[model samples]
Target: MYLKCGLLEDAEKFFGEIPLGNVVSWIAMITGYGKHGLGKEAVNSFNKMQSENIKPDAVYLAVLTACSHSGLLEESQEILLRLCCDSMVKPQVEHFSCMVDVLGRSGWVQEAKNIIECMPIRPNAGI
Candidate 1:
């Protein structure tokens, strides 16, 4: 639970000591890194997870949000797209919101709006 509360070092130690990690363990580390504003570390954790063939679910979107928080829009876009197109995870409104936020934060408000407009499914508010 160190990762859950923003303890990166302890979380890293825990992760390193474990020979095998479940989805929750990996996601916890990714989320922890993201929460602590370590966007690149979060992305690296994501890479580690994928290398282990662990499929990401909605929670991994936390990493996407972290990307936006850190102004890494391009990487956020690529990661989000990969989650859908390559990893086979379905895109939900939360993912779309992350895209919108990323684009908007990057000053591509028009692109963000267009994405919302052209979305196959309309985004419901209050996600």
Candidate 2:
């Protein structure tokens, strides 16, 4: 609710009060931060979630989207690379799309094109 209303501080405070933050709650925080263009906060929340032993699932997309929106090219690339190396989480087409968006937004059109070309899955309209 707070996040939806753009009350990030209130949202963060409430989130911190939760006794046991789950993946879903963490996703909310990350996606909320992304929606507000707070990429650093989103990344910090991602790291905190991991430190709490909450393994990321679809939340990867949220983080990627956050980085893309904030033009964090290097962070996006690092996250993509980490995703590729993590056997637990398989890189999906959506993840690739976010990476492309980040790269393209950062004026790395050729890199974006290369990423699309090397994608294991077929590019969809979303890409």
Candidate 3:
């Protein structure tokens, strides 16, 4: 509610008050924070979600988007690796796109090209 309205603090405060904050709640906060360019807050919320034993599913695309927007390149790379190796989460075209965007934004165009070349699935138009 507040998030969509650009009221980040209010949204975060309301979110924190939820007694049984589920993945949906967390996603709302993360997505809102990301959209607002509050990348660190989004990442922190994600860490807290993990601490609560919430396993991120495909919806973590929001987090990657946040990281990409903020140029959190190293963190994004680590997340990409973890999504592949540790969590067994399938990387979608959106995920790869986020990485490429992050790399390109951070002036690592060569790296982005490398990732596109090495994609397990054929690089889509989005990438």
Candidate 4:
């Protein structure tokens, strides 16, 4: 509720009040921080989620977006790699798009192109 209205502090307080916050709730906070371009906060929330033993899925597109916007390219790449290698979650078109965008924004156009070329599946129009 507070996050939807851009009330981040209020949202945080509410979030902390949710005893044993579930994955959905944690994702909400992460998404909200990302939407606001609070990359560090979003990353911190992600770490907190992991500490709580909440497994993240491909829905971390929000986190990727936040990292890209905040210029956390390394973190974005690490997240993608972790998702691909350590978890059962598969990267979607949205994740690839976000990665390319981040790389391009950071002047790594060639790297972005490499990602497109190396994609396991056919690169979609979005990529």
Predicted model with the maximum lDDT: 2
What's the true lDDT of residue 36 in model 4?
85
Q: What are the per-residue Cα lDDT tens digits for candidate 2 across 14-102?
A: 99999999989999999999999999999888888888888898889999999999999988888888788888999999999999999
Give the per-residue lDDT digits (tens) of candidate 3, residues 27-88. 89988888889888888888888789887885478888999988888878877776777444
Tens digit per residue, CA lDDT, model 4, 1-127:
7988999999999999998888789888988898888999998888778777787874478788889888889999988887778556777878888889999999999999999999776888878
Worst 10 residues of 3 by lDDT: 80-89
TM-scores of the models, in the order given: 0.89, 0.97, 0.93, 0.93
Alpha-carbon RMSD, each predicted model: 1.8, 0.8, 1.2, 1.2
Judged by TM-score, which candidate is best? 2
Using TM-score as the measure, name the better of candidate 1 and candidate 4: 4
Q: For model 4, which pairs clash?
A: none
* Candidate 1 wrong stretches, greater than 4 Å: none
lDDT of 1 at 78: 83
Ten contiguous residues with the weakest lDDT in model 1: 118-127
lDDT of 1 by residue, 53-118 (tens): 877775558788778777778788888778778545778788878888879988999999997998
